[model samples]
Target: SIHLLYTLNIFEFSNTWSLTYFRPTVPTDLWDAIREVELSWAFPGHWLPSKDPVKTVYFSAGRQQWIETCGAVTRMKGLQSFTLHLSGSWFCEPVEKIPVFLEPLRDLHLRQRWQLNLPKQPYYVKEIRNIDGDLRKRGIECSIRAV
Candidate 1:
């Protein structure tokens, strides 16, 4: 059954042509299967790095829907991890912004880890380390790796 599945990846979605915009929602029927979610702004093509790499999870969805989704995830009893695969050097700011981006998941008591998959040519290592430290304080294990 789909409910027995353990992972889901919502990498990209589009209305037409290119993957310019998307607002993802896990159907209630499959929420039981969502142990991990791998999200990216654009899917890889022809073995090439995506031009529109994941900058952040601060998607501009409707505010109410965003809150509702956060509530849904918080209710998930089996959610384990969320992977944010960053494809470029867009993380120019300090660790300040990461918390707000991640605040929605703070209520996810069942979530055990948060992984940041970075590009080979990552930009701010120190900033990443700082973000890691902040998440550590929240008791969530964070792993950063260059893919």
Candidate 2:
């Protein structure tokens, strides 16, 4: 039954698509199985690194959907550090959204020159600084670097 459901879900949705039907209300075991299937579909084979070559991993998702999809991949065990490379005008709501999505991330590097409406306010810088301070207090090292 589980296998059939998994196969059907995969067949209906493309590799990069999300299973919107599967929510947190679902049974724990079933939800875990679905997540495993999604992960497998996203990364076909041999996704893990053999040698621990730099704990930091680089990821860039131009679309909002891809960001949400990759967010799950980031939560996987053994990925302690990350660098999010943003290109184009991706409107990332740092204050409300990003922090929670990237919870428990020990080391994070944000590389982006944000084009904000209020250039004088420097909201992006201030937000990053606040996030950095908050993360630091929780023993997480957050830094911004040039892309």
Candidate 3:
């Protein structure tokens, strides 16, 4: 399991793969340091066979914040593992648009670690499953947990 610790608007990456992230107002030095780390793409039950540079990301921002920083995220060419803790506002738009927003991450290992916060309606679940299938066909893994 990965833990996201927030403290004084600073983001830190620990040896245990635990990530810390706050608002986009965090210091530039912290972000620069993050881009310089050599990280192992290992999780609790699964392990990656290779090493990468700061490939893991845990992002949890509101819709407004997401809009403000989505461009930066899309430009992250080295990202491999990403976890998104979704908020309700994420569903304000069409669910299909979610994939569109993440189109830039097609090369990522995007495994099943998405945490969704939405009602468990069959329509939403089915749509998400379809998206998951599409991503999987492209060699991307996605799993949604409604919480």
Candidate 4:
């Protein structure tokens, strides 16, 4: 059908365009425009690096929805609601590696190893509890249900 062919062409065009022109210096506006694409029908990003490259059952860090090289967060922009299927691996960030920018994330799920000989530190629990409390204060509905 013509619709399928046209879409395929657009996909091809976007793919080629990303490879030919997507660059870090291309400016955020350009990235936004590229992101305004028909994302659901297209697969963009194969030229950028993921915001987070590692994942584990206990943790996953960074973003991985880039549109050009397909390794960044280009597609996550403006998304109001959706399901994010993340894989759990062993190489995720340590409890100590949490960055300052972690505040904006609304949902957090942490599954730790049952056999760890280490006890939960006050700082870690405080961080999680603070984030949870903050969300609860705003009535956003939060929890740490068992996994």
The model with the greatest TM-score is 1
Task: Give one digit per residue, the lDDT tens place, for model 3 in 8-102.
Answer: 22332332223223325545443433322211221221121124433222222223333434344333333333444444344444566556544
lDDT of each: 0.49, 0.38, 0.39, 0.30
Q: What is the lDDT of candidate 1?
A: 0.49
Report the C-alpha lDDT of model 1 over 33-81, residue by residue, as the tens digit: 5576554432222122224434222232333344454555466555676
- Prediction-by-prediction clash tally: 0, 0, 0, 22
lDDT score of residue 117 within candidate 3: 34
Ranking by TM-score: 1, 3, 2, 4
Name the lDDT of candidate 4: 0.30
Ranking by lDDT: 1, 3, 2, 4
State TM-scores per candidate.
Answer: 0.53, 0.31, 0.39, 0.21
Q: Per-residue lDDT for 32 in model 3?
A: 33
Q: Which clashing pairs does model 3 show? A: none
TM-score of 4: 0.21
Q: What is the alpha-carbon lDDT for the whole of candidate 2?
A: 0.38
* Sequence-dependent TM-score of model 1: 0.53
In candidate 2, how many Å is residue 100 off?
1.2
List model 2 lDDT by residue over 10-81, tens digit each.
Answer: 322333354333334445454444322222132221222225343213222223444455554334332222
